[model samples]
Target: MPSPRPSLTLTLLQARETAMRFFRPQLNLHDLTEQQWRVIRILRQQGELENHQLARLACILKPSMSGVLARLQRDGLVGRRRMLEDQRRVLVSLTEQGEQCFASMSLEMEKNYQRIQQQMGEEKLATLLELLRELRGVKP
Candidate 1:
């Protein structure tokens, strides 16, 4: 009989945790959780996005996104506004402080990324990223 295969989902999660090991210190130093860092990163790149859109991109659930946004808002790192055209729709964006925070952390994050690329050569890192993107595009 053939040996059992390892669980793909668990393996992917473990890989993610391994990758996060390099960046978690920076996040913790800024008093940010992984979820908050994701939200901030997305907002920085995309400018302003609707709450649902932000949640989806950040891989956060609707229910949990509320708390995450609440904390960010409370900390004055992000701001939310209701759409005038669609009252139900909420928009989220990074505030000045959020931008500053991102700027402050950019150097450390870049260094960590460089360290990773150095450890796992640029070609290998590129291939891994491409494979992950392709895997994400796979249809169930």
Candidate 2:
């Protein structure tokens, strides 16, 4: 028989859902969907990226990225430009409006993170992050 509370996938999903509960309201306040916010946040941090690179880093499917990007572009939150040296290579970046939105959201997100850290204790939170990175195969 399967042991209760022993499924890795289920535990991960539960953790994600719990965190999203806190973040969803913030996303709604910004009038942004999760995927849109993910795109904006990554663009804000990385400056410029190819659509595929952005999609991969944001954990968004490549097919879905085009639509997300289109909406963000229509909303004036993202810009797409072809490379001068390689015209076929399209690069994407956040616009000034996007930057402003990101800055505002970042403040609230950081506050939420601090709350979680306080609840869990800073050391435990750090250790959890370390273990998660290990599970994700990210180099320390």
Candidate 3:
């Protein structure tokens, strides 16, 4: 007889779903989708970036990033400028408005993260992080 699958997969799935549920409400309050927030967060982390670099760092496809960039530009949250030396390269950065939004969302994100850490406890969270890195074929 075939052996039953391990329960770890289910546990991981449940953890992901629960975390998303917890974050979704906070994101909604910021009037941002998860993808939009991700782009903003990436820009904050990397400072200014070229369009292609932003797409890669955000882990989003070029086409999707085009739309995200458009929306952010329309909302006055981000600004784009052509590189002085390389006119073909379009650089993207968060505007003051975008920075403010990110700051607000960052606080909420931190709170959510702290809650999760508290709930999972430090040791379990550390173990989970190590396991995830290993699963991703990354050196932990």
Candidate 4:
């Protein structure tokens, strides 16, 4: 028989799925995939980044990032620019439309977070965030 202890990895995934349940519908309304949203969110928060850096920050593989970036550029949501000083470096950032998309969706996202806070209790939510960071070996 399996051990009484549940899998931590599976529990983390289930928790993520439960949370995405709230965000997914809002993402769908904008015709954005999870990957695209991740890309947009990172760019919006962190400003311009190279493909490799963006790939790392977004947890997207290099090949997948190419395709995702292509689709985003095609959709007018993101743009890649060559650095003025170093032509070899390419940086990616959200376009105006992408900013607008985030602006529009952020209200709903914040409201969902508020609901989650209400359900989990503000202190518990804060503790969970802190614990998750600690679990990742990150200091506050």
- Top-scoring candidate (lDDT): 1
Indicate whether candidate 2 or candidate 3 has the larger lDDT: 2
**Candidate 2 lDDT, 1-140, residue by residue in tens:** 96687888899999999878878989999899999999998998888999989999999999999999999999999999999999998999999999988988898999889888888999999999999988999555
Provide the overall lDDT of each model, using Cα atoms, as 2-decimal numbers: 0.97, 0.92, 0.90, 0.95
Winner by TM-score: 1
TM-score of each: 0.97, 0.92, 0.84, 0.91
Badly placed stretches (over 4 Å) of model 1 are: none
**Hey, what RMSD does candidate 4 come out at?**
2.5
Best-first order by lDDT: 1, 4, 2, 3
Write model 4 residue lDDT over 41-127, tens digit each, in one string.
Answer: 999999989999999988899999999999999999999999999999899999999999999999999999998999999999999
Q: For candidate 2, list the clashing residue pairs, or say none.
A: none
Model 3 Cα lDDT, one tens digit per residue, 1-140: 99988897798889889988868998888788877888899999989999999998787899999999999999998999999999999999999999999988887888898899999998998998998978878455
By TM-score, the better pick of 1 and 4 is 1
Model 3 segments beyond 4 Å from truth?
Answer: 1-14, 137-140
Model 1 agreement with the true structure over 71-137: per-residue lDDT tens digits: 9999999999999999999999999999999999999999999999999999999999999999989
- Angstrom error of the Cα, residue 78, model 1: value is 0.4
